[model samples]
Target chain A: MKVELTLFGQLADIAGRTKFQLQDIPDTDTLQKKIHEMYPEMANMSYSIAVNKKTIHENTVFEGDANVALLPPFSGG
Target chain B: MSERKIKNIFSQGPIPATFIAESIQKHSSQTAIGGHSIFLGQVRADETEQGKVKAIDYTAFEEMALEKMHQIREEIFAKYPITCMHVHHSLGQVQAGEICLFVFSSSAHRKAAIDSCNEIVERIKAELPIWGKEIMENDSHQWKVNK
Candidate 1:
């Protein structure tokens, strides 16, 4: 299955892109690992993962096509 | 009536001072509200090693932020005896010294209006998934971190 993965804040700058599709990524942990492999600089940065607009704490298996987002520290007023 | 409605608070760019005045005037008919509290956030120019910041480009995960804001609004209303509340934030580019966020709260007494307005501003900063990129005069950019 393919999932649309979006990166926000500094994560997007690090990734060099914002939203794209991921194929065959099983869970959040795998997704993070793949991103780190592609952009090693992202490995040291702090971020949060959200699936379908809800933030997730632990690795969550994808049951179907999902919308995933990588969020860096928010700075809003 | 209490609200569960999701309010769209994002404005295109800088929030004009006239819009804020009009908002206050709209509430004049609701004379039951004895006190009104207002908060405005302005973009400040900061000098960085690269250059001086001239403006800010603000963006947000809009679909999620509105949902989060709805929850915050509900909680604020439940905790404070506020009769009315309104919040507005800016998207796109806002120049330095321009107003970017506006929050207003009204109540029968001064305390609830003041307290709730403060709380709402705090929550918006802490909880919303918005980001600001400081655009420098040298054409470089830096991400903003809330202090």
Candidate 2:
């Protein structure tokens, strides 16, 4: 299934774009691996995956289209 | 008391001092509130290996931040006997020495207001998804990580 991938902060800088479409991404684990494969630099950074606004801690299988965001470390005051 | 709804806690740029003063002035009629505590976070011009930091350009996953802030607000209110609280954060570039965050809490007593204000600031620092890119004097930038 195609998923909407959003990158924030330094992750966006690394990705060079804020949003993209990941076609045929199967599950959260695969999605992570696919992203790392696509952007090896991302493998060195720490980030969280929020699917449809809720952070995912465990491996979750994606069934349909979802809004996925790769959020880097927060620095807000 | 009326039900408090989730508010948009972001401002486009640096929060003005006048706005903060006006907020305090508007609360004068709230006779029940005997104490108020506020926390303002300012951008610091820290020296880096490259050069001195000039400003911080902040960005966020705003939808998630707002939702998390709402939850934090409810949690703080439940934990303290405060009258009300307000949290505002800057979105774009905030120069060094400018206000980037404004947290205000009021209560019938000083202790509750002070404690709640502190808690909110800590929580926002630890939990919010806002990110800052520190721009240096030479115009180079680095991503900031909260300690």
Q: Rate the local accuracy (lDDT) of all candidates.
A: 0.92, 0.93
Off by over 4 Å in 1: B1-3
lDDT of model 2 at residue B30? 96
Report how far off residue B82 is in candidate 2 (Å).
0.5
Among the numbered candidates, top TM-score falls to: 2
Once superposed on the true structure, which residue ranges of model 2 sit more than 4 Å away at CA?
B1-3
What tens digits encode model 2's per-residue C-alpha lDDT throughout B1-147? 327677899989999999999999999999999999999999999998878999999999999999899989988988999998999999999999999999999999999999999999999998888999999999999999888
Clashing pairs in 2: none
Cα error of candidate 2 at position B133, Å: 0.3
Residue B50, candidate 1: C-alpha displacement in angstroms: 2.5
RMSD versus native structure for model 1: 1.4
DockQ measured for candidate 1: 0.87
Worst 10 residues of 2 chain A by lDDT: A58-67
Error of 1 at A12 (Å): 1.4
